[model samples]
Target: MPGYLLVFFCGVLFAAGLGLSGMTLPQKVIGFLDFAGEWDPSLALVMVGSAGVYFVFYRRIIRRAHPLFDVSFHVPTRTDIDQRLIVGAALFGIGWGLVGFCPGPALTALVSGYDKALIFFVAMVTGMYAYRTVDAIAGLRTDEGTAVDG
Candidate 1:
C-alpha cells in the first residue's frame, strides 16, 4: 500500500474504533470523568483495550530505529517542565474538560454532524496554530534538552 493509503486506513480504523466504543460522544467521556456523580465505567474498558494494543506494539515500534517507510521516528526529548509545555498542557486539559472533546474523538465526532463538535475542533486547530506561531517566534523547541548521539 502507498504511504498515504496506509495513513488513511489507520485513521479510518481509529475513527471506527472510537465510534464503536462510543468514544465519539462527549456524554460518554463526561460520564466517565464525573466520578463523583452518575459515573459510567464503560470508557474504562476502551482505555484498557487501547492500552493493551499500545503495550503490545509499542515495544516492536521502539525496537526499530526507523519505521517501515524508512522515516525516522520523531520523539519528544524535552524533560524540563517549561512554561510553554505547562501552558499548552493546561490549555489542553481545559479544552478537554470543557467540551469532553480531545483531539482523537473530536475528529471522530465529526460524523455526528454536531455544530458544537465543529466549533470545538475549529477552536482546537486555532489554538494549535497559535501555539506553533508563538513557539516559532520564541524559538521554543520541545526537544531542547536532548543530546542526539549523531
Candidate 2:
C-alpha cells in the first residue's frame, strides 16, 4: 500500500477507535476529570487499554529494521526534563482540563459538528504557528537550546 494510503487508513482506524471508545465526546473526558462530581472511571479503563496495547507492541515494532512506510523512526532520545518540556506539559494539561478536548480526539470530534471543536482546533494551530514564529525570531534552533548558531 502507498504510504499516504496507509496513513489515511490508520487515521480512519484511530477515529473509529475513538468513536467506539467514546473518546470523541468531551463529556466523557470531563466526566473522568470530575473528581468532585459523579466520577466516571470508564475513561481510565480506556486509557489503560490503550497504554497496555502500546506496552505490548512498542518493543516489537521498535525492533524492526525500519517501518514499511517510513525510512527511519523519529523517536525522541531526550530523557532529561527541561523547561520547554515542563512548560509544554503544563500548557497541555491546562488546555485539556479547561476544554476537555485533546488534540487527537479534538480532530476526531470535528466531525460531530460541534463549534467548540473547530474553535479549539483553530486556537491550537494559531498557538503552534505563533510559537514557531517566536522561536524563529529568538534565533533559537527548534527544540535545541538557547544558543544561536554562528
Candidate 3:
C-alpha cells in the first residue's frame, strides 16, 4: 500500500536522477573509467555529491527508532573484510570497467530499447542465477558434512 507506493516513487526518482546525470550513457561511464586516457570527472562529481547527501542524512535517518515503512532499520552487521568480499569486489569492478554499465544504469537504459543494455541485463540475470545455484550447492555440501560429523 503506502510502503509499496513509497518504494515505487523512490525507484522512479532514482531512475530519473540517473538519466538526468548522464549515468545511463555508456560512453560517459566508460570515459570516467578511462583515467589514463581521456578521463571524465563529471561522474566523480556525481559520486561526491551523492556521498555528501548520504553523509548529511544517513546519521539522522538511522537515529530514528523505525523507518517510515518498516519496524526497524535493516543494516549490515559484518564489518570485517574477507577473501570472498575482495573477490566479489574485484569482479564487480572488472565487469563495470569492461561493460560500462552497472546494474542500475543498465536497467534504466533498457527502457530506451538499447540492445547492449538488454544483453547486459540478461547476462547480469544469468550471473545472479549462477551464483544462487553455486551457493545452494555449497550449502547442501556443508549441511551434509555437518550431519555426518554429528
TM-score of each: 0.78, 0.84, 0.87
Candidate 1: give the clashing pairs.
none
- Per-residue lDDT, model 1, residue 29, is 89
Worst 10 residues of 2 by lDDT: 141-150
Clashes of 2: 0
Question: What is the Cα-based TM-score of model 2?
Answer: 0.84
After superposing candidate 2, which stretches have Cα over 4 Å from the reference? 133-142, 145-150
Ordered list by TM-score, greatest first: 3, 2, 1
RMSD, every candidate, angstroms: 4.1, 4.5, 5.9
How do the residues 1-150 of candidate 3 rate in per-residue lDDT, one tens digit apiece? Answer: 999999999999999889888899989999999999898888988798888998999899999999988898767655555554566678889999998998899888889898888999999989877865765654522222221110
lDDT of 1 by residue, 1-150 (tens): 687789899988988898899888898889988889799999999999999998999888988979877578765555667766666678778878777888899877777789998888888888777976777787776654565322
Displacement of residue 112 (Cα, Å) in model 3 is: 1.1
Instruction: Give the Cα RMSD of candidate 1.
Output: 4.1
Total clashing pairs for each candidate: 0, 0, 0
